[model samples]
Target: MSHVNAALTPRARLKIGRLIVEQGWSVARAAERFDVSWPTANRWAQRYRECGPAGMTDRSSRPHHQPTKTPQPTVRKIVHLRWKQRLGPVAIADKVGVAASTVHAVLTRCRLNRLSHVDRATGEPIRRYEHDHPGSMLHVDVKKLGNVPDGGGWRYVGRQQGNKNRSDTSGKAGNSHHNPKMGTAFVHTVIDDCSRVAYAEIHDDETALTAVAVLRNAVAWFAARGVTTERVLSDNGSCYKSHLWRDTCAELGIVHKRTRPYRPQTNGKIERFHRTLAQGWAFRRFYNSETVRRKALPAWLHEYNHHRPHTAIGKIPPISRLTNVPGQYN
Candidate 1:
């Protein structure tokens, strides 16, 4: 049956008719060989006599008229709204009073709705991404910054304000003999797993109080930009395990997760951030003094969050890539 249907095509019908005439094969034999009905073979032969090979050509299978179809004007409107106004199919459908699916189909057919995405935080254009909806998991983690030079030999730009009585002297002690002001500052940091937007701060200590403060600061920073801290992963450090940190998470209604003992890679977001920070900011240039390095931290962080383009987040800045802004980080 299938073979007979295929033989009805113009090319096959024309070939079969020609073979029947040339080989002088009977209609029944020709029909049997070609696997076509006898009537079909006879009709094809007659068509060949009257109109030659052209008459044996197959006709289109599509119906001549489409009674229930989207109007041409509506399709044109869909394409125009998508292209000129940059409206998505759903929005366009709402405005034009049509089914969203219909608008999508029309826009797809016109190939006019495929617009590139732009990172909202960084204000940079981004390639199209597959994960366009919400409820997608985004991870976060913090890293303690290592003692290193800031950049451009700016290690000692800012004044060191310690205990009023404390002082330092290179030869021995600058002002106070009991306490020196030089030490490694911990960098409290967080990173988004999906967008790779990192929030980091340098602090004189990594105590539980400082950890809570940094986490609060990071939350506020992300909140201002509309990125939510869905879940935060961290190491099992004393500061991270502190009650203050736990209370802060509870207050913010965020989940605080810790990595396995001796396995920092389990919270790799901030780990990767630490590596980038070291390479891009810490080791990017030389520094003259720790004060200068500490002072330059904020500017470096700003650059990292707002100016430095990321390869993973469609080359967009972290601020541009964030989407939700439910409430203030406060």
Candidate 2:
């Protein structure tokens, strides 16, 4: 492994060694000439005498002795349990009579700590892809948020006093309370790849028709700002796969793209947007009512698009990268 701290290459090391040996330069002189430490120059000269050119190459820094290390058989057993049974470190430790930390260390050293690193049946690395242009790809997703109680809920009050707050808001919180099931609002979002500009709207449901409507609005939003919607990326949800969704893409001349099953990161940009949306808008304030919170969405989005700096696109506002749209946000 080439390390950033390695000041000299193998070739340089060999040349210095030769200068000290073949050219008969002193260790101190060779060290001074090469701008290396005397100890390093001396070590190189000694290594060259013992092993010649091959010794000049990079060598593993692993210690020769590891007396208290886990035995090979134990490691093999642990690996087998992890790969075969798909057991976690704690379970593996319980089965193998080792500490959980020990099992974790073994797994990490074997490069098997993350299950995503390899396929269970066949150990193959997962491949990731990225697109270079902003408008070249877009990710669409829907996030569900529960309707807040009339005033505020448990987040404002303590968890223990949450029921009291709900009772105060809903007028005796019980099975008989109106809409006791707790209705949900779906937030449909579209995010660009390069600039990460996002447009979102809340809806009653995430049906195919609703998704299409959101997509059309999002596409238009991006278009107004100078991003062309060339590709639509989403998860394999029913709404995304429906003919309604496909036909909408056809009408818009967008290449409808679906992530591989169980791979949400394939549409990672919008997924990350949902997380930001939750942190920044949904949970950022104590709203008197759901209507107040809903009303605040546009302001937060305006800030995110026109003011908040995004680290991915060089720590500037997403709108800063806009080429299609000119003039500043009023």
Candidate 3:
């Protein structure tokens, strides 16, 4: 495989090769058109001539031989011990009479390093998918963030002060998920699969009513920009499964889809958004008060949707994926 900093991908190399080898283009012409160096173009041309299409594919750079590698019989013994005893590298090393590192290397090469990978209880690997159109599917989820106190709390002060803050706040807050007077706030999030356009609002509670309201607002927000929401993807939380939430989806002409039990990856988009939200908003600043922090969400959201580059969609802002919009930023 090409290194991370490699100048061209396999397809680009193939295209360059096709232009030079098949179309009788000059090397200088191929290099100029592909925006690659002459040496690079020559190398690609040579590789393509030698192996045709197969040469364009990434190949392992591992050496042809390893003199220090474990012997085949020893490797077989290591594998046998790992399977029969279900032990880790350290334990297997003692039994197989090899270094722990060597056992680990053998296990890794054999694809038996992690027992969880082969365990029946772990389930099959998840197949990631994305909706083809904007608003075709929106991943919805809620994340709870503890309200930051006045002038900030532990994050600002020392650990001792943080412990004191925790003790002081624990006595005042209500309900099961305890915290100080800052109280937990729920961030209801909605993100479109195709464009990665996101909507979020912090509310006091996460309920069927709150979920329904957020969906309505998000749909309206998308509608203004000409993206008609066609479906919603959510985890099977109590609020998501509520009849009110169902009726809300029906009224909006959206098909509501839920992730499989305990399989949150099905709704991975919003889950990933929650991580970004935490870093960009909840933890980005030392808010003097929860109210002040709440006010900052709109600005941060604007930056995310209109300014920040998203990797999945070619490092462009999510709004750029919307149709009929001119370039708004570099």
User: TM-score per candidate, in order?
Assistant: 0.47, 0.63, 0.63
RMSD of 1: 21.0
Q: On a 0 to 100 scale, what is the lDDT of residue 292 in model 2?
A: 90
- Judging by TM-score, tell me the better candidate of 1 and 2: 2
Q: Give candidate 2's TM-score.
A: 0.63
Off by over 4 Å in 2: 1-86, 90-103, 114-126, 159-182, 207-209, 236-243, 259-268, 302-330
Higher-ranked by lDDT: 1 or 3 = 3
Please give, for residues 1-330, the per-residue lDDT of candidate 3 as tens digits: 676887898989999988889999989999999888999998899899999998998878799998987999999888777666678899989987889999999989988888854433343323458776787898899999887655566777766776565556433564475434666799999999989999998999999999999999999998988888999999989999999999888888999988899876667778888999989988886776677889999999999999999998889999988862444112
Count of clashes, each model:
21, 1, 2
Ranking by TM-score: 3, 2, 1
Residue 17 in candidate 3, Cα distance off native in Å:
20
TM-score of 1: 0.47
Q: How much lDDT does candidate 3 score? A: 0.84
Worst 10 residues of 3 by lDDT: 118-127
- Pairs clashing within candidate 3: 1-59, 169-180
Total backbone clashes of model 3? Answer: 2
User: By how many angstroms RMSD does model 3 differ from the true structure?
Assistant: 9.6
> Which candidate has the highest lDDT of all?
3
